[model samples]
Target chain A: MKKHNYSAGPCILPQEVFDKSAQAILNFNDSGLSILEISHRSKDFVAVMDEARSLALELLGLEDKGYKALFLAGGASLEFLMVPYNLMKEGGKAAYLDSGTWASGAIKEAKFFGETVVVASSKEENYNNIPKGYSVPADADYFHCTSNNTIFGTQMKEFPSLDMPIVCDMSSDIFSRVLDFSKFDIIYAGAQKNMGPAGTTLVIVKEEILGKSGRIIPSILDYEKHIKAESMYNTPAVFPVYASLLTLQWLKKLGGVAAVEKLNNAKAELLYNEIDRNPLFKGAAAVEDRSNMNATFLLNDAAHTETFDTMWKAAGISGIPGHRSVGGYRASMYNAMPIESVQVLVDVMKALEKAI
Target chain B: MKKHNYSAGPCILPQEVFDKSAQAILNFNDSGLSILEISHRSKDFVAVMDEARSLALELLGLEDKGYKALFLAGGASLEFLMVPYNLMKEGGKAAYLDSGTWASGAIKEAKFFGETVVVASSKEENYNNIPKGYSVPADADYFHCTSNNTIFGTQMKEFPSLDMPIVCDMSSDIFSRVLDFSKFDIIYAGAQKNMGPAGTTLVIVKEEILGKSGRIIPSILDYEKHIKAESMYNTPAVFPVYASLLTLQWLKKLGGVAAVEKLNNAKAELLYNEIDRNPLFKGAAAVEDRSNMNATFLLNDAAHTETFDTMWKAAGISGIPGHRSVGGYRASMYNAMPIESVQVLVDVMKALEKAI
Candidate 1:
């Protein structure tokens, strides 16, 4: 069966990246050293690092500016704490926009460090919509937001224009769209989603935000520490970062972020359109705030859950089960997700509707 | 020219693991979904998590004891802070045996969290030997030690047989020898050295040692938090851990740690013997402390450095350059090094000796 992956995160990567990355791991750039074992300091490996950093800057339009692109070892979960450690000071505050599980997690991490005033929260609406009309804290260190909620299938169409720095966890929808890089101070993502692989976390941070925290941050958790060390504070997850770099190169060759966003939009539209028209399936999140990355829906009758799962699995659709938090069905449409995969998922929905 | 991989860390992997790992990243475990893209919660991936944990236990001879193995996202460098965070309490002093660079790093991190007493240090001797006659603190929270020094080839042949919780940073020497699990409260290592890859850090901690620390650790850095959550406190570095699991399975199939150790010893013996015999090369570390993993050596004549590097590189010998800290040459004969590779280095040294 040609399995279509809809599993949320540690998610899919471009096929080209996989092929190239694997080849490198076996024999890195024909150096006869497997990339998995090469020294990060070697000329060949350093080139990989340099190119990865360059590609990140190119993707985000930060290549010319002084923005620093770093590939960190820990996943975004580690970043949740690292962010507050770098930015928030004693009695220092940050405004948070809570939309879903991940957003709440970031907020939870921040409270331990200092004050985090939630500027907007969509929990009142069960996280089916983005909260609006809350004022960004002028005195806050920065405004933190999750760009896309992986489980809830809701997204921020535009970042709030804030005078304070902007820290966005774009883990789910990073490469899914085109955006101006100037609006944000820090943009981070786990590579498993819309990048290349798991293990490495991508941090695009403006240099000005760091060194503000009076607390002595541990070397690994400090962005300025990594930035100064060129992300070689200790050995990084080399293979994953290399894989991510390859994926970035592929993304650039396919016309950078602009082309990726268009394909993502097309894929999401096909599935969401089917859900909107079908009587058996109902789109869960608000229409305007609905993610073009993850499409979540519920069956009209709850008994159809098993049937839906069985049908999808047999049809070679994998990872379509909704998160336990929002239980029904969710088809995550990441960048590596093909239009054909989404089409098959849509076809399965149609087949189910006819049978019902 | 076939590149001889001598680049340390992210250096080389068994070719078989590389091929399969790459294919899975494209489409995991024949699941037709990219391994990078799968949900860490899925049954297929959960098995990977479980198998890796079990195999780690088996490799360390720790299965019967209630030892919990976890695949953490942060590299060993982060474990520097995490160790003290999970074990140290206010006014609780830990006895630390500083062997080399990494041991010093661990000590630095420990100081931030609690009082850390340097029981003994070989820094006075340029870290060429593991300190002797050191007393392990019975009242101390834990006795921290680094098992192997990568840059400086040295190892702790026999740990102090003290009735104290032994916490070891086995980053470079894990799986290089068979360990008696009962002695240590925790054994942690970065995967790049003797394991599968670089991103994932393996941690094996006794169930009882956790929750003893009074400090409120950040969730991601807490061992107890990870154990309770079954190492799923956050999404792990799935692909790297999965690859490491496959390598573990390979290691077990090749007769577990006991079997691999013989091979490791033979490789070390061949190189150390050659260094001792050759007038051109002199071993750097103390005879008692020489590492069976990374072999540090210096040429008697500094001018012959280029000649040696050229000879080795031409013969496809790699990663023989000494680290910057000890600038001569280092031949890291890790777990994956074929004995033939070491034999070739011996032959090269012999040829150079005859010409001189």
Candidate 2:
């Protein structure tokens, strides 16, 4: 069976990226040293760090725009704590928009450091749509939002340009689409989806947004310190950063973010169209807010569930089961997910409907 | 030239461990999936996590001793903060022995959470010797110490048997020797040194010592939470843990820590004897406290520096340069370092002496 992976991270990466990364692990850049064994400070690995940081900026088209990129360990979960620790000061409020589970998680951590205000939330609707018309308070230090909800399959179509700094968690759909990167004061993502692997996280912060928090942040949580250390504050998540660098290089070779978004849209459209037409399935999120990255849906009739699952499994599909909270199906069509895989899924759904 | 990797951390590993790890990164356990692409929640990676955590306890001789082992992201640097975050309480003092750089770093973070008392320190001697006859206060909530100093080449030959909890930073020389597993309440090591590679840290904690701090620890920093979640509290440093698992398996196959320790001591003795015997070289640390893992030394005559350096470089030595705080040389002979490599380094020293 031809494998079609749709796991929600440590997710899909370009096959070329995986091949190159595997080679590097064996003998990094012909250094005759396993990438696993080399010093993080060595010239070979340092070049990897430099390239990963610079290429991240280059792909976001944020280079020379007062933004610095960093590769750090601890993933987006750590970033939840760090964003508030570095940006939200004592006695100050940070506004948040809670659309789904990850957004609520961010809010929970931010409250530990300072005052957190949820201006709007879609949770009352089970987070099936993005929160609308949220007002950012002028006195708030920063406004936090999750750009995409991985489990609920809802993506923010337009970011709010607020008077305060805007921090966004773009973990699942980071490079899958084009975005106006300049609007974000800070952007962070775990490298498991649309980037590379799981160990490292990418943090891009605009310089001016730092140093105003007036709280004593730990060195590990301090963004300025990491930026000053060139992301070598401690021995970094080396392999993941190197793998992400390769993916960034692949993104550049495929004509950068704009080019990749086109294919992503085509893939999402193909799958969603099949879901709507077949009557056997229905889309989970609001049609306008449906993620082009993760397409969440469900079998219209519960009786078809086992049959459809068996069909997809026989066709070599994996990780299509939705999060327990959502209780349906989520086909994550990340950047590395080719249109053919979407076609395979769409064809399976059609076949199931025709047989019924 | 053949490579001789002697980096202080991210140092060296058994060739078979590296070979097996490299294969897993390409196709983990023949799952036909790159370890990089697989979901950590999958059965394949879950087995990896289970094996790594279990083998860590087995190698430490702490299995079934109520100690829980966890693999986490961030190196020992993060452990510096986590140790205090989980164990130290408000208005209580934690006694510490400041042996070297990492111990001081651990002290710095501990102070943030509680009153820290430095019971002893070797800073007066430029950290070249481990402090002796230090009293661990009974009233202190815990006693913290660094077991080995990578930069200074000092190792604690014996630990203080105290009434309170004992936390050790064994980042430099973990598993290179045997010890009474029940003596300490907590042991943490970065994977880069004697274990495997950079990125992940191994944390072994006694179950009873946790949840006493009364501080609201973040989920990422809370040891109890990680233990309860079986180190799946967050996505782990997958590749590093996988690599470390292979190294641990290699250790067990080589008859475990007792066997590896013998080889480690022989390698260290080979290099230290050369440092003492060669007219141009001298060992740095006090003889009794010198580390078996990192053997720090200096050139007696500065003028011979270039000649000696050239000799070692020509003989395929790498990363033997001493840390800036203690300059000259540091030949880190970790568990995986073969006695032949030490012989090669010793031969280089003798060749330099003959040429002079």
Per-residue lDDT for A347 in model 1? Answer: 91
- Summing lDDT over every window of 10 consecutive residues in candidate 1 chain B, give the lowest-scoring window: B2-11
- Model 2, range A89-175, lDDT digits (tens) per residue? 888888999999999988988888878999999998999999897788899999999989989999999998778899999998898
Candidate 1 lDDT tens digits, A1-356: 67787877877677777677767756777766677777777787788888998889888888767789889866788888988988898889988999888899889889888888998898988899988778886899888999999889999987788888899999988877888877999999988888877788899999977787787987778888788988777887777888888888888898988998989889988998999999888999999999998888999889887778888888888777788878888888888888999999889899988877
**Chain A only, candidate 2, TM-score:** 0.99
User: Model 1, stretches more than 4 Å misplaced?
Assistant: B1-5
Off by over 4 Å in 2: none
Best by lDDT: 2
**Residue A138 error for model 1, in Å?**
2.2
Indicate the residue-level lDDT of A110 in model 2. Answer: 83
- TM value for model 2: 0.99
TM-score of each: 0.97, 0.99
lDDT of 2 by residue, B92-120 (tens): 78899999988988888787887899999
